[model samples]
Target chain A: MDLSTLSLGQYTFVQNAFSFGLAVMAAATLFLWFSRSHVAPAYRMAITISGLVTAIAAYHYLQIMLSWEAAFSAVGGTLEVTGYPFNQAYRYVDWLLTVPLLLVELILVMRLSKSETVSKSVTLGGAAALMIVLGYPGEVSEDAGTRFTFWVLSMIPFIYIVYQLVVGLKGSISKQPENVRGLINGAATLVVVSWLFYPLVYLFPLIGLTGGAAVTAVEVGYTIADIVAKAVFGILILTIAMRKSEAEGNS
Target chain B: MDLSTLSLGQYTFVQNAFSFGLAVMAAATLFLWFSRSHVAPAYRMAITISGLVTAIAAYHYLQIMLSWEAAFSAVGGTLEVTGYPFNQAYRYVDWLLTVPLLLVELILVMRLSKSETVSKSVTLGGAAALMIVLGYPGEVSEDAGTRFTFWVLSMIPFIYIVYQLVVGLKGSISKQPENVRGLINGAATLVVVSWLFYPLVYLFPLIGLTGGAAVTAVEVGYTIADIVAKAVFGILILTIAMRKSEAEGNS
Candidate 1:
């Protein structure tokens, strides 16, 4: 987004979101990492992956926040673009690495057949990677046609991923322990809904929003999604692990 | 991940990742071999496997770095992809040898019953070798369908190995002296998590990252995973061996 100018409120709103996103990620990383012992050994890898996702997200949010502060000069009453350019690659890079892993952790926790887990993880992970990588060009493009074209390209994989998450994983989630069955569904739905939210935020600029408002909507919208997809969703995954761990007779 | 368009920054990122990876492996090899005397005689083989894993990884990193330099020309102000096809086979070859040893080291250090050790080692190591062998065809394939097919083939062994590491090893880890159990879990998680990361990075090219970006992601991503899975993981194993030795009353 081309943020030529911003009011103090808009600037701070994004800043707050970034800070909050960073905090959520940091907290989630520690929570998941240290709690590894609480779960049975079989489920540790899944929870560990959830910790990894947040740890990487925490790093990106930190860098993105610094970039946000650098690009906008808010020291004085004037809010103007600075000589330093903001790097948007951090968000895409984070998504590229973490999105696939998110699917992986979910698949790992399900305790599916070895072949099925392998099959689902590779297919779903590859699709998630495709969706993130495809979205990057359109995200950085200034032209409407370019943005719209890439959006459609990225959506192809996005649809595939969501279908797999919902329909493909339906049977697996049902086979989970009775206690975590609802939470597992919640986790899957949370992933789909949060992922769906990302494209809408990507469309803020294409859908008539421009300038500072577009920038704010896109940034804030993404922060909310980031928190939901990584941290809140991670906590949900962790809770499922804990429940399954308890069911298996572990304290 | 074929080398093509590259900015100076992207070129350097891969170069730097290679160099750092090389340094870690080289350092790890020396550290493991020299430190081997500190562990009990029974655990020495485990530490020896650590050295072997890092030593093999180090050689590959050196070759990989050289290939990377040969594949790209950045002597002048202009940066360009050059004639040399960066030999990625070095990685597969390295993994083919060391991956089996990775599991062998873990199993040996656990000090399992000789019969159980032989059985688990043969099974896990064979699976590891099969995983790497199955993965190479897909790695070299240009078609997405071919890559996906081989990825599925490889995941079959990957899932079996993970099961052995998690469920199969759970009872064994619990039987270990308290000090090194956490370290063992860390090592296992590191292997699984890093191994999982490699597949997703392999998908980068197939997904949408083309030309320079795909090459950059694959190169840097693999380098990072290599350091973690081989060198860093080797050290973790070494530490566990030392702790176990001490717990056995060896200074």
Candidate 2:
């Protein structure tokens, strides 16, 4: 947990995580900003909410980067940068806010009945926040048992989210225009697959990987997963939304 | 480069890369196999060829993993696992064979005129192979200047491939069945974007990151990019092919 003791490799790994996170944040923001006008009125709320998720994430990542830089500077030339443990709290905060909205946007883009949208988003989104809240304890837990327990607890909601997307929403997704049915399935599956990484990351210590190896694996894994889940998933959602909007116009 | 000399961190990095590559290979192969029956007759060749690309890469990655394990055992248990430099030649070998085929599959799936497909595949695929071949010397070069020189040289072909995909193929792509045009464009753009990582990976050593840091960066970067380029691109290609074939059938 001490930033002062990190090896150069670990330092680079964390820095790269921040860089990757920030890049995704910026790219997603720019994409949503530029493309929002092109989305349909029915889909515009989803697009705007998508932009909000990235914008919020971008801000939080900037704070994390600053924390990283501060820690790096305090250590001067030494790879074992001393001082504050870069507060990763910013990431949890970011996810707590954005994760639920991710599901909300998906629901919004689907154009289900208002009551259906509200009920699904509230239930799924609340579970998403709880997933983050539960997983955070495991992420910070030093004991293997505690981490494993938290991981299992988090997966309860994670599994539910996947089930809701895969089974519960199957009908709604099928009702989408044929052109976008494949993409709708792809987006849902992408979320389920990518979100599975968090629990895997939490179990790294149990697998006997500690120090820089564990650190690098967890950070890099999460970064890759986030890119797929947030940035790539967002793009898929946009594509589906655009296609459906166009289809409705033609019809 | 010495597997025996690798720190545990380096060992883990290489092992993770191998795992990732093999996983991608298996996933892509399984996807193509399962979907082959469903894809249209005209598009079957592309799906089959896509599976071949991953199958070939998987076999090569298995070899790379064996070489790594051999080196690790020879080094014994020391963190400073010194001596044997794990051969990365397998990667270049894999790319040389598969990169060209990637382009060919793309061309095939598009179902362009036979003459156009042949010419574009030969030119683009040949250039893709050349890019990897040209870049390999620089990858192993101890001298940064040699590395940068070769990296830039490789970019000549890389740029041409991009140009061919983006500009030269524009007309042909535009003629694709209307429903799948966006998907086709997405696939082509994915290729151009993902391939850009190669030159960037080449520049890592030049930026004063050497040894394990540079190795990990380059390997991890390439793995991520390759997944995007090959596996993800294959999926996009399949989706496009499926949609187009379905549209044709309905018409």
Candidate 1: lDDT of B205?
A: 67
Interface RMSD of the predictions, in order shown?
9.8, 14.0
Model 1: how far residue B173 lies from native, Å: 26
**Model 2 segments beyond 4 Å from truth?**
A2-6, A73-77, B1-251
What tens digits encode model 2's per-residue C-alpha lDDT throughout B111-217?
Answer: 98868886888799889989988987887677878988998899899888989899988999889888888888888888888877877766866886667666676
lDDT of 2 by residue, A18-48 (tens): 6547645654665565566557788988888
lDDT of 2: 0.76
Alpha carbon lDDT of each predicted model: 0.82, 0.76
Native contact fraction, candidates in order: 0.00, 0.00
Worst 10 residues of 2 chain B by lDDT: B77-86
Across A1-251, the per-residue lDDT of candidate 1 in tens digits comes to 56776788899898999999999898998888788778876687687778878877886788789768977787768787764446566788678768988998889888889789879988999999899888977876778899899999999999998888789888888788899999989989999988888888778777788888778878888888888898898888888888888998984
